[model samples]
Target: MPLAQRVHNLPSYLFAGLEAKATELKQRGVDLIDLGIADPDLPPVDIVKQSLIRHLDDPDAHQYPSSVGDLAVRKAVAGWMQARFGVAIDPAMEICITSGSKEGLANLSRAYAEPGTVVAATDPGYPVYANAGAILNGAGFRALPLTPDNQFMPDLTLAEGARLLYLNYPNNPTGAVADESFYREVAAFADAHPETLVIMDAAYCELSFLPPKPPSLLQFSKNVIEFHSLSKMMNVTGYRIGFAAGQPEAIAALVKIKTQLDSGAPVFIQRAMAEALAAYDGVNPPADAQESHNEYGRRKALLEKGLKDVPGVKQVYPSPATFFVWASVDDDVAFVEHAMEKGVILTPGRGFGEAGEGFIRAAVTTSADRIELALQRLRDE
Candidate 1:
């Protein structure tokens, strides 16, 4: 009756602790303005909802789906990729539907990672990158700290021996966006190594505020595998549908691993995701994107302005893409507790990685009014 060491050795999932703290505050009658997790407040687009409704009655929707995915869904994903990033991929050979980008990431580890295999990830990054190593029973996890001096891009030189290098642009927590030149550097580095596989987590690609949205790493090199999620872009987090596209062999390997893991994403959800992707022109921003941008813009402006005058807040990190504001502080844990006591919930940066210590991450997913209230609470504290 002993648990596996892999399960026992894993660090506590970051957000679970945040949720528990929020619950404790609620029980104590504190009306909390949560700015922790990046869960969008919006619902899925009309077309996506309609597609789900139309497909729910189809008999095939109830059965287990292929591990690779539905054909139409893969085709739609290809078209979307072409339209969005001008990168063409063979749907049959390069695409694999996943329950979410996280599922695809974990499965990539299962397929390729092993003990002593080095996996390089940006510190203050999404926990999934590091957790992938833990799942492999102690794969070497290298922390490539993203510092201000480096413009928040990890130095590829530090990832020398890494077999898997994970990069997330329009980064979570930090909200830093990688440009084409940055991708060119990555491509060169990958070319130099030749054996390393680059995993680009583009979950926040569509959330860019600037024109001519973020470019795909595939535009620079085929040596990289990219993950895309509808959760952030289309506000369909509950659907748990996304895709991984890259080298055919890597896609095949992921397919082999997933075949033993679980069946594919739900058919109705995949159908809805396909319809949504098909309708995307990649020229005009979707209504959901426009709405989210405007709202996050307003909240970000308010939060930045307010933080400038707050005590203990050292710097408000620039966020041109994701729905988060990474701020440098004297002590992350202390600031989180102080903010919580004043009825505002902010995520401590240390929860992301050790390099995140002395910082805090506040999500702009809440309403402008609530963000204003949270700022007032911080000022009062």
Candidate 2:
């Protein structure tokens, strides 16, 4: 008659009421322009689609895949890392295929965190880093604040002795990115704390609009592990294909836990994702990928310009990465609720952590024309 204690320990879902309100508004014929979630609007590039279609009839697609993933997919991941970041990776020893980066990230804590020790993650970050990681595993959780003064990256030194540390760049919610210099700092931090297994969430690295592109943590740290998502980079979010690569020990630990939990991601999906990863053309993507980045950049610029005239927006955080615009407001909750009433949905920042109390993030994951209309409504209100 009751759920597990861990389920009860989970924090209340912040958007439950928002979803209810949106339903009521839509029922009343209100046209809601949702800018809340970071789901890609575009379909996967042709190569990825054709690959999946071509592989659909393979007899292997119907059978169970290796828990660590098929050799072909792992080799694709290794090649991508080398081409994209000049980072050398051994597919057999260092790569583990994951259903998605979120799964690997949550499982990193499961593999590494002990019950009494803490799992540290950047605050105002993806909730999975805390909820499904530390809390579900009965490990203590720590919020290492990402402040504007630090360019939205917490000092990794603060997480010393932690069982596992989660980091993201071209970050979600904040749109901040890290550079090679910061990664060097990360390397130093890892060296200082050998017990801490640094986990880099590189889901958005390839989607940045800025020049010089984002740097990979692998360039500087052997003590770190990275979970990358083809879903975000290839506009194939539903495919749920990603991989964890880095320190061999970290990869082995995750693969061990994953084996006990379930079989590997669907074979067809893995092969399809391999097509996408193999197509990545170094730091600057090929035609289709660049087009998606450019489109999101335009939408983000339009949203930022519109926010300049909006009533409650105090400041718009400018970072040359991610398809999100983080805006400071007097009160994030009040601002989001007011926008919802006007038929535009956004996520309040405080839902992430206390560090996000005064901000709101806008995901430019819609069409330009629809985004224009949404901004106009906000201006009108």
Candidate 3:
């Protein structure tokens, strides 16, 4: 069978491959602390689960969902935007529910990118952004190197004719975030470009621990479209519930492509997502969830402390948000492989981009005890 050229060019997700290897080792009776994946260890509130189960047997929910999502789900998403970011969005025209933010982001790229079109993206970014660009075939993706010097934000001034610019905060692999001034500058840059379509991937927005709640693309430009996923915040990665909100025209283009893919996410899932979003404002993290965050915070602290004494480890700082720590380690691939051999799986930064080489991304998803154990193993190695 002839696979699409785009599929041929896309590499397997680095973290995914690492997790698979860890699983293989575990099956062979090796004890491993699997920290390569960013999946939250918490479950959504019981309310969300109960809501889904109640609708599970509803014959109506068994049918295909509305293409862009049921009106209720879209309204919930818009309400979420307004409540969380103070950004008013039109539920009917400016929002679309996707199976996952990943789908929305990839489809958005396909919708807007054409041959010879240039896209500006950050290095050490979520690889899907670049993958999405490559799949457009005619589009050229230029990775704007992200480094400690610039505080991990891309310098838009360096990008030219950039039709699509991808920004991820609480950034994957790095866990770095930009400030409001940075966002304002990006907004001004977008205004100057006029033609550029900014695609902001805010999957980690709800997971932030910093102030100002991480600026939304809507806070910057109307030309921006952004994605959110329940996979992270609601601990429903398997549910594939996510949404895109912003720019009416961009949402319309994505919806057009979406209609041709699968019917929207399952109706019951959308209903459950609505319930989750509705309660998000007041829903305190369950005791277990709270404990998990504490544990992760401890793990991050441990990593920060340990790296301080490790030779050749540089730019080690605590990320104000997200469940991962990014540190620059010379020979990151070697570092990752060495950790894996010691039963602690880590994702190599190089897997994200060339600039990512010599860096290692460690996920803080495991239990505190396990994290401590992993740290010990890391130090011993």
TM, every model: 0.96, 0.98, 0.92
The RMSD (Cα, Å) of candidate 2 is: 1.2
Report the lDDT tens digits of candidate 3 across residue range 1-381: 998777777776666766677778888999988777788676565766888999898788888777689998899878877777778899999999999998888887777787778877889888877777754455777988988888788888766577788888868878888788877887788778777887788898766754546768796777778898888776778899899988899889888988997689999999888877877553344444445555566677776676565544676757877888888887987788778888888888899998898888888777767877887777773
Best by lDDT: 2
What's the lDDT for all of these models?
Answer: 0.85, 0.87, 0.79
Which parts of model 2 are misplaced by more than 4 Å?
Answer: none
Q: Which stretches of candidate 3 lie over 4 Å from their true place?
A: 11-24, 282-295, 309-312
Error of 3 at 121 (Å): 1.0
Total clashing pairs for each candidate: 0, 0, 2
Q: Give the per-residue lDDT digits (tens) of candidate 1, residues 171-248.
A: 987889887899999988877887788889999888887765889888898878899998888777888999999878
Least well predicted 10-residue stretch by lDDT in candidate 1: 281-290
Q: Using lDDT as the measure, name the better of candidate 1 and candidate 2.
A: 2
Candidate 3's displacement at residue 233, Å, is 0.8
Superposition TM-score, candidate 3 onto the true structure = 0.92
With a 3 Å backbone cut-off (N, CA, C), the pairs that clash in candidate 1 are none
Top-scoring candidate (TM-score): 2
